[model samples]
Target: MVLKYCLLLFTTLQFIQARKVVDLTHTYDKDVPKYPLGWLGLENFTYFKMDTLAAQFIDEMWIAFKKIEYYEHQGTHIDAPIHFGSGRQTLEEIPPERLIGPGVVIDIRNKVTNNSDYAVTVQDILDHEDEYERIPPNAIVSLNSGWAQKYPNANLIFGTENTSDPTTFHFPGWSVEACEMLLQERQVSVLGVDTPSTDPAQPPIYPCHIYLQTNNVPLLEYIANLDSIPPRGTTIVLGAPKVRGGTGGPTRIFALIDDDQEQEITSNSASRNFMSAIFAFMYLNVFRFC
Candidate 1:
């Protein structure tokens, strides 16, 4: 009976674990900067509206979500193919299959601090091939340039400090070369970062965005707390966020890690399917028991 209880508990825990979610968004505030070339402005944000005891009864007032309407480009956003081209997926077409993948992190803070225009290169991806090998295709390749820590100083963080150079944008970006390395070579479906844009903060060289999205790739910008995810062996989840015909909706994201004593997570779909079924059964049983 004790052995059976242990199995039941173990199965229950493993099953419910598949759905752990993480928030990969950065809050929009006054400090976020607009590129000199970009024309965007926030029109409505939250201003204290009237409170009333109406909806539920029992002295029920609400501090509601009266949002300031602005372009999706203002905050942490996923760019649709239509953002750059006409007649493209309006954020709704992003395939779930492509949206989630093995999360890859390349910490380029040191190099980026020295040279703000640093482009993520082929060699950089090569160095982390071992990590990438573990993640499935269509995974999110996140570039960590330590840029988010500079959020307080939006100007300096964007690399607009005393450089007097146009490429003074402080962090690294996916080079068109690196984009190919990620997409064509690695076959990644999405590219992500913690900075304002996926491309380096420069003009006449938006190649990274063009290259990635031209192939229907997506971008996740303004991510934080990636330090929590393991370097490998974790399944990242983008829970189904319901936004109607929305080109892109803000996502809640996180990592699902599996520690197997015998086998490692790989490209074997059959194995993954089996594991997923086991977890699903466990979760259903737990819910039933509860």
Candidate 2:
């Protein structure tokens, strides 16, 4: 009986591990969204063939190339301590372990809907602390606060629009205290948010940036579709940007692990977002060290 029970348990765990992976990344088009006050969009780019390539197309088609000028911070990206720190590691210097890890998603969409700028507090983290021990130390902490509705129109992604209507714009950011909690107390590897930034859009630029950097933590912004991940348990893989000394670069994000399809799709709107992310980018990559 004991042997039989152990075999059954192992089989169940294996079944759970066999679940599929979902891509939670948004395809960056010429009109990738931005914040209500921010100015960002695709740039002028062209693909042309050089001497031999042009000659090949007209004559041959060999020396061909594509070129454009754009910001490294465009699209889904990650923020490094150097983003806010005077002297810190750049994108290239960032380790793959630091970029990717177990991902933890926290659902606060309802709270955010009530107040666009509603800051995530320590209570918010503690409110769901029942699963705190499960959140690994080097994991990527993601906060799902449902700030994507405002970006239905690509114009808002640039953060520039008429403010006459109250629903014109909204952003969910982390509070200074909450930032301290994740940085100083929790000591997470990285803090990710499914919004324009990790801090509230107010008089200050990035409170989370200041605190996290001071505390040796990093931040990832413009992450969408966190609603689909479980409040905990899902492993997060961070795809670091290939920028040299840049402060921040876009990211292709996702959540991996077993999440009840019923709650993720029908019952839990937040989990739906994470599922959406998994659907977007199917090719999930593990870390590579040279």
Candidate 3:
């Protein structure tokens, strides 16, 4: 019976270890939509053939380079604290550990569908907590407003009838009350959104950004594929360029899924010790007999 159980546990461990990685980033191209604000979007990528077989600096050296210009906050990007808040930490000040963590996706797609100008409120957070329990500390809380499907559509994605007018823009995002709950009360480290900003478009002032930046919480904007990730139980890895004193920059975000539900690979030291004992028992008794 011990040997049988040991084999079964080993197989289960192997299965759990084979984690699946989901890319939660959008590919930025010329066609990709820019935020309706007056800033110029990504410049056309200019490529130059530096060397070839006939025009090579060395015998077998071939090289090419491209000049690309885009706003730091353009595409799938991270907004460091210094983006808005004065005397706050920049991109480099955010430690690597803070960039990755267990994540929860707060989906407000239905609300967005009903009202494009809807804002995620404190009640939404409380409701999610009532259902899913308290969100883990230092977790990356992602707001999925279901706007990613309209990517590359400058008009639709920004929810603006006039691309030039910021006042006409409309979309779903975090309300000030919601930010207070998540940042001040829950102490979440990062806030990610599928939209252009954490606040609803056309806010009198970007209160969500102000609150988060003042509190030194980074924001990940223009994230894609939140529809694929679960509401909770996945680990998020943020890949962004670490520019010293950078106010913000583009980032690549991803997640690792191990199980279908709350069931996850063990990390508790006591559980690890218990598993070790089982492994030792199997090696000493079952393996020798075999």
Per-residue alpha-carbon lDDT of candidate 1 for residues 178-211, written as tens digits (9 for 90 to 100): 8886777667777888777788876635777777
TM-score of each: 0.70, 0.69, 0.78
**Best by the TM-score measure:** 3
Between prediction 2 and prediction 3, which has the larger TM-score? Answer: 3
Instruction: Give the Cα error of residue 152 in candidate 2, in Å.
Output: 5.3
lDDT value for model 2: 0.64
74 Cα displacement, candidate 2 (Å): 3.0
- lDDT per residue for candidate 2 within 113-158, as digits (tens), equals 5576778888888876775554567778878776554443644542
TM-score ranking, best first: 3, 1, 2
